[model samples]
Target: MTERKRVIQTGWNLENSYARLPKSFFNIIKPNPVSSPKLIILNYSLATSLGLNGQALQSNDGIAVLAGNQVPKGTLPLAQAYAGHQFGHFTMLGDGRAMLIGEQVMPSGERVDIQLKGSGKTPYSRGGDGRAALGPMLREYIISEAMHALGIGTTRSLAVVTTGEFVVRENQQLGAIMTRVAASHLRVGTFQYVSKWGTAMDLRALADYTLQRHFPAVDAGGNQYLFLLREVIKRQATLIAKWQLIGFIHGVMNTDNMAISGETIDYGPCAFMDTYDPETVFSSIDIHGRYAYGNQPHIAEWNLARFAETLLPLLHVNQDQAVKLAQEAISDFTKLYHYNWLTGMRAKLGIFNEEVQDEELIEGLLSLMQKYHSDYTNTFLSLTFDTRWDVALFGSTEFAHWYELWQERLGRQKEQKASSHQLMRSSNPALIPRNHQVEAALEAAVKQGDYSVMERLLDVLKDPYAHSTEQIDYATLPAISNRPYRTFCGT
Candidate 1:
């Protein structure tokens, strides 16, 4: 017998709550129509979750919408304006190459931003062409989906539409647009924009709107802005901790890139660490390693402090009292980060109970990983699944000692061995988007029009916790390279 199909329309339930805000928040504009619109990839799962018609989005009309060639019926396309601290210098920046079409209200009544990246130039284009290259768009799709699968807080990609044109980066590269879905595109820089140039009322209005949208639980009265600051700090603390736990490096952690929603925002120049070195840096622009693997927490705190500064006018009536409260809230970052990181690391090592030695045990393994140049993901993975330590990295005497301590600590916990093992498995993914593999997949798709590589990568990435045979092909160590691997922003 044949089964009936579930037909869905291409209609997206879009609303423009952001557009209702004062005009300073965004510029009302439509995306620049692309030359040719082709829907190369569609995340059917994400599409369905957003109450969209997955197949209908692949239709001619849908492809046009996805490629920014045509605006959807319900969306109010606009470009956001904000300022950010690039590197360490403060500068004005915004969605120069992107437009937030509108917010999609889902079945659960949750609102999310639907933005088209690489759509075209905006008033805040900053003298550069507002376009995106195929490779970077594909990279964000891969890494962001992989992050979501790995249970990390991140901005997700719903589709990738090729623009049948070329964007000049280092060389001529095929242009593409990625549909980025986020809780909202609110950022620390968003607050800074209003605080620096906007009037006192402007700052309060943005804060009140943000508080209601992102943190409605924050009390309406009685220092709600300070509460908002605290909430953002807490979310960012845990978010950075999760990134560190997964050996993921954000690469560019500018204030603008720091999402107020606490999801990892931009994916430019980002890569997962193969080796466990805390000092690992991959972005070609990060000559100083400001956004290195280990520095994520510090950068998050710094960004939060900048965010706190913006809330000072709303934090308290007395300037001194406000400063004290913000400072106090900011100081909790170290403790919050350490607690969150250690809690995650404990699970990665199959430990169910906390002890004084727990932090030391984790640091010991990390130190050994750095000393032996061990692969970060695989090191924990070996303990989670593999019993044998035949590999030279774990064969060292130091690792052996650490192993004994770990085992002893595991025994001391109340949970059964099976429970501990299960936790470890759930905590540590068997696979990550390895840098070399990701580059190869990007090259095949962008240069040769071969998508099978990316398809397989995405397949294995979907079920990262399970011991699937297909994952083995992608889980192996990245090929040794002649020089340091570098990633570009592809701006």
Candidate 2:
């Protein structure tokens, strides 16, 4: 196919995803339209990666598709069916407000689900308006793109479109739709959705289909079921570790929000920590700190248990036998998550081999950071700089004491001693999407119709570890009055 053909919609062969499913699992429906549509942000890189036209995706035709203006040919826009345990409570939640517009098979032979979040309701809408507010839409667009740039596996925002209408949140806010592209929209909750109302045959069919589509190699070995769980565990471990290393708080860790692919999915009320606090909580809904910074690892384990419960019936014949197998598999989460987290943390601090005292050495630095309330991203970035002068940013005399231990620890490792430090410097970013910067970018867009700042922020974030004198200002944390930033649901 020629380059231009990539932008054209060819109707999907639904048999690949929908043909094998029982009708009770999903209610097929078209997307509901909003009042008016206007493009907010276009992720051309993500579009091009999926063998889509970068030019067309940024064009009116592409924006129309993203804004739910025109359902592309061969697409089936339906809100997926799934049930999730929200904040430890089981709730019958289905897409709620998001609608999936069929799937795309990429040049690399990967099938991706192209979904429009905030594209209005379905039978799953419950009692809501099926709309998304402008703030959260823009937030997902910025953060998801930023995460992708960081080399962490994450859903990409193909486009963000304003509905040119208002919705009631804390107050009236503009409505918008986010074109979210992902490996698959299948979540652990999807299994729960099917299992709750589906028969044994239906659940088995869903499991078999998932194995074929996402874990095909396992299917050939007659261990597809076990293999699928293993793969999901590894992905979630690595994904959660990446988030923690970068000081990202997912804010909500509901079972329904967990992606089977393990990429970071929902971006609601999510925020990066300006100051490293294990107890940091950003979501307005997380009033009791259920999904706090330090609690994520445990929460991920909890979610995996929910996933295990849904898969138990398919794992073994008897309930006790099934529970035994599920528990054995779920138990791997802690070691896997900590291994990934510790290894990444070691690299960030320039350590390699584990020492009996290394745990203290690492924990000591974090304690110092908490004592001084240091900027998590910046402190790590500064360590990768030429000299250790920037260590003062930690705001503690103890920081100097800790640096001595760090330097001594570095003496034991031989990977990059001097040169690898440069590599580490590059791997560690000097800038992130600061809460203030994102807010400023949105303010510029909403008030003045200017996206120049947003574009500029994306540019800086793309080369996060580089030292750009021109954009050095973007590297600094805002003053206290400017910080403790709070995000909203945006309806």
65-175: candidate 1 lDDT, tens digit per residue? 899887766568999999999998999988899989999989889999999999999988998789899999999999999999999999999999899899998889899
Residues 422-480 of candidate 2 have per-residue lDDT tens digits of 66676677778898899899888766878899889888877676667755788777767
Please give the TM-score that candidate 2 achieves against the real structure. 0.93
Alpha carbon lDDT of each predicted model: 0.89, 0.79
Model 2: residues >4 Å from true position, as ranges?
1-16, 58-60, 386-397
Score residue 373 of candidate 2 by CA lDDT: 73
Cα error, residue 429 of model 1, in Å, equals 0.7
Best by lDDT: 1
> Model 1, 415: alpha-carbon shift in Å?
1.3
